[model samples]
Target: MTPRLSNQMEKFYKFPDPPELAVQLRTYSVQRWPTMNHEWRKNKLASILRMKARRLASYWYAEESLSPRVDELEAILALLKLPEEVIERENLNELQALKERVARLEALLAQAGALDLGEQVDGGS
Candidate 1:
């Protein structure tokens, strides 16, 4: 059986490695070079983590510092809107009055139409 195995089959049976095993092996092997030592990689990771922590802390600080000011400005804006709210109420009242006037005019027109219809029926007779 060993004698019957081709070179490619022999290597496959000898190593029995997955396809991606070579890629992972080569990546780690390159990192083991003298210039890419373990301590440097550890420090680099530490610095990156520190920078991220500092950024998040600064964001939290800004939000906390500005929260009360934001609330104050919102309160001032509500105060500024008082006059507009009053104007809106007045406009709504005027619209209701116009609607009532239109209803009265429609009722009068309906009565006049009925009178004309009656007159026409009597005249035809």
Candidate 2:
């Protein structure tokens, strides 16, 4: 399989399987399944799953639409995964060094009378 597909499979495996998820959902719901009719139970389950999918889609995609098809929801969740890449660690040391260098250069320019202190330095010392 392609690397991207492999990575997606790896991510998908990290989450619980559909059956386990369904069981968990069942436990989470307050519905009394034994008293409810079969057809109504099935509809309720489908409704719960779709509601969950819409919530997840809103969180992950930042946009919500009318209900997506089951296959579309599954594809979106299984393939796309969470946005773990949104945040990246910046090189703080490098940034600090650059800031210090700029400060020093600014100081030198001020000393040489090349830089005016008349509201030009907005970042007041």
Candidate 3:
């Protein structure tokens, strides 16, 4: 008897490397600033997070004390009561920006007949 492959097994999964993941998290946090509830809290946390991101990025690149930075990040996440995974998900504003960019790129590529309609329709199956 042949075993059936799960949907997860059928697709390629590529996670971002540590530095890239840090950048993504930082970008997500900064993008979240405008929609944050309280004005002062929003400004304060955002600034602190950016600073932390800079420090963390430097330490990450230098291979220095990483645990402290990670602990700081966790504390920030806990104070915010936000899960890291939720923060990693694309927000609405970012989604709209990405959609616009994709549309523009698609238009340009379509002109050059570089868009693959078949693969898109088939969902790469």
Indicate which candidate wins on TM-score.
2
The lDDT of each candidate is 0.44, 0.48, 0.52
lDDT against true structure, model 1:
0.44
Counting clashing residue pairs in each candidate, in order, gives 0, 0, 0
- Per-residue accuracy of model 3 over 55-93 as CA lDDT, tens digit each: 545433443355334445554545345665565563556
Clashes of 2: 0
TM-score of 1: 0.28
Compute each candidate's TM-score over C-alphas. Answer: 0.28, 0.30, 0.29
Local lDDT at 45 for model 3: 53
- Prediction RMSDs, each to the true structure: 33.3, 17.9, 20.9
In candidate 1, position 26 carries an lDDT of 31
Where model 1 places Cα greater than 4 Å from the true spot, the runs are 1-82, 117-125
Question: lDDT by residue for model 1 over 54-122, one digit each (tens)?
Answer: 332332233333222233333323432346557468557867998999999888768868777756655
Worst 10-residue lDDT window for candidate 2 reads: 82-91
Residue 23 lDDT in model 3?
57
Residue-pair clash count for candidate 3: 0
Superposed model 2: Cα runs more than 4 Å off: 30-35, 51-125
The residue pairs found clashing in candidate 2 are none
Over the stretch 24-123, how does candidate 2's per-residue lDDT look in tens digits? 4443232334455544544554554454544543323333343334553464344334243321122345457889999999887786565565455555
Off by over 4 Å in 3: 1-48, 52-54, 57-90, 114-125
